[model samples]
Target: MAFLGVALLGLLAGAAVMYVLYRPRFEELRRQAEAEAQRLRESAQAQSRELLVQAQAEALRVRNEAEADIKQARQALLKQEERIQQLEERLARSQEKVDRKLDDLERRERGISQRERQIERLHREAEELKHSQQAELERIAGLTTDEAREIVLKRVEATARDDAARLMRQIEQEAKDEAEKRAKKIISIAIQRLASEYVAELTVTTVPLPSEELKGRIIGREGRNIRAFEQITGVDIIVDDTPEAVTLSCHDPVRREVARLALTKLLKDGRIHPARIEEVVEKTRQEIETIMREEGERVVYEAGVQGLHPDLIRILGRLKYRTSYGQNVLQHSLECALLAGAMASELGANVQVAKTAALLHDIGKAVDHEVQGPHALIGADIARRLGRSPAIVHAIAAHHFEEEPQTVEAFIVAAADAMSGGRPGARRETLDLYIKRLEALETVATSFPGVQRAFAIQAGREVRVMVQPDAVDDLGSITLARNISRKIEESLQYPGQIRVTVIRETRAVDYAR
Candidate 1:
């Protein structure tokens, strides 16, 4: 038993030694673990504090940006509000101007109404005064107002009639003066522009003999040759007293021309027998016909006329043998055509129509003996039958006043005819005939009631009549001149135109005291 006790006590001592060594080491390890946990907790708290501070700073920056944005928006709204206020002010001023214009219009309307009432009142007063004055005048004059008005109107009408008549006379005088001046200028220019030779052709043909003795041979042994010659040629062979000249006289110019040619040939050949005479005369007639045609064509060409009928040309050729008032009809016709054409150019008329009409104006004289009408009318008919235009035909007919000249061409033709016939030395008149024409002109002029003396001047182209001033007034003198002109036209058959002039003289004589 004693050995077991000692062994247990030794085991207990070893256990106590092990407990003291392990307890201090265990306390130290637990303190180290607690301190490491506290350090980890402090690190986590500091990190969280820094995160919170950063978040607050970020929130402050965001709020400042929002405030700045709100300030800009407010500034824009304020500027817009100012603009609206200005617009309102402008609208208010415009309304004020409109109100002023309306007020002015209303005032003008009121003033116009007042003026209209005043005018009505004044008009009534004026009408009353006029009626009172008219009544007083009627009472003083012892005549009705209508009677006074009629008297005044009659006087005024009489004065107006006198004034109208004077004005009409003055206008007539001025117009006549202007027309006369223009006519004179046109005629003078036309005459000055054209210079045509005036040849006075005789109807009678004269033949020159080599000797006076040849005349007896032409008479041919006891008048038998003469009679045969006359019978064959249809012309009178006059053995006149003239030296070395034999006269062939015939109304038919063609026959006269033929006789002239035959006589010439007979004298030249010295063969005066009847058979030779008939043969020579027949040959001469043929030659003359040929000459007539050639002459017709020559004139037509010279005058620049075309498209004439063959028959018409031949008839125109016959005019070469015809004479009018001692003027060759063909020459006169040519002159008329040239003058008419010149005048037509100057006056802006159809030159061809004028020339053609004027050239054919005397064509009727060719066959007047055969026809039963005036030469103008006959010529017109011939031209119409030849397919001439109406203007041409009318011009031909009216050249001699047979028909009233309708166109300017007709008047031109008439004027050309006058110019051709009226030129100096163009025609010859017997002294007896000329004297008779002058006397007839004077007689016609003096036949008027108030004519003191009448004088035929300008070779019967003009008549000057002197009128008594007391008997024929200025107006009366005009009437007398016209009447005298009409009488002369009716009585006289002279060539060209005649002018009538009437003169009235008013004399005032006074002696100085």
Candidate 2:
């Protein structure tokens, strides 16, 4: 029991010592924590004051900027109101000017109306005075108004008839003179400018041989080579006494050309056999065809014409081998084209159409052997088939008067053809045929009734018929001329044109007292 009491007292004493030591340390820690909390509170208060000051300054700046914006908007509105006021004032001034113009127009209209009424009154008074004067004149003339008018009209009729007749004669004379002068001038100019070579192509082509020995070679064994050449070329080979020359006679110019070429080549090669003749003839034919095409192109280029069909050009080239009355058809065509183009330019016609028509005028002669028609009509058909224009086709057809010339270009082409054909040395006719034509023309003219005498002048171009004055009056003479013309046209196949003239004159014989 004693030990237990002493142990308990020792434990209480240890506990009291521990409590005293820990209590001082706790007090020191608490004082430190309170001082830290106070310092943090003071820092927070200072930061809050600074934030409040920044906010106040920002609010003041924003208020000032907003007020400035409102002031600018008010100023802009005031300026817009001033502009509106100025526009309104301008509109008012314009309105005033318009009103003044309207008032002035109204005054002018009123004045015009008054003047019109005065003019009408004056017109009525003048009409009344004219009627009174007419009545007075009728009384003075001792005739009724209608009778006096009839007399005056009769006098006027006589005067007018004489004047009109005189004027008609003068106008007719002037027109005839002017037309003749112009025609002569154009024809002269055309002839003067165009100085083409006159070509006289014949149906016979003469081939000159190297020697008379060649003629015998050409006429081979049993004349078999000559027979073969003729059979192949459709040409007649005539070996005459003429030295070193053989004649190739064929109506077809192309065959004649081919025969001439073949003969010349055969003579050159010195191999005149039947087989060789046939071969050489064919090669010559192809060469001639090439030559024809080249000639056609040459003429087309020389004429400055374009867009001709290949087939048409080939046919035109064939004209180079053709001859009409001893005139080379191709040269004639070129000459006519040049003449027609010149006349067309002077007359304001289509120059290209005129030239093309003239160039192709004798195209039918190329194929006339195959086709059965007049050359002009056949050429027109060919042109139509080749897609030539209607104007060109018409000109081709009308060149020979087979068809009536409708356009100026057609007439120009016809005139050019006449000029080319009628010029001296352009063509030739046999002397016998020429005489027969002139005689036929005179006979036809004399055949008409009341024809006293007839003479063919101007190289048979014109027939002058003198009629008996008693049998044929002026009107009958005109009828006789027309009849003679119609008869000549129906019966005669003449070149160019023929003019028929009838003359009638009456003589009243009375001795002067």
Q: Write candidate 1's Cα lDDT for 1-513 as tens digits.
A: 888999999889988888887989989999999999999999999999999999999999999999999999999999999999999999999999999999999999999999999999999999999999998988999989889989999999978766776787688789989988987877777777667556678765888889989988888888889999999988998898999998888878888889988888888899898999999999999999999999999889877888999888999999998988789999888888888888888789999999999999999999997889999999999999998999999999999888999999999999889878887788888899899989988988898788899999999889999999999877666667767878877777777778888988888999999
Give the local distance difference test score of model 1: 0.89
Give the TM-score of each candidate.
0.65, 0.61
Structure candidate 2, residue pairs in collision: none
Cα RMSD of all models vs. native, in order, equals 19.8, 12.2
Instruction: For model 1, state the Cα shift of residue 61 in Å.
Output: 60
lDDT of each: 0.89, 0.89
Candidate 2 displacement at residue 90 in angstroms: 56
Strongest candidate by TM-score:
1
Model 1: colliding residue pairs: none
RMSD of 1: 19.8
Cα misplacement distance, residue 449 of candidate 2 (Å): 2.4
* Number of clashes recorded per candidate: 0, 0
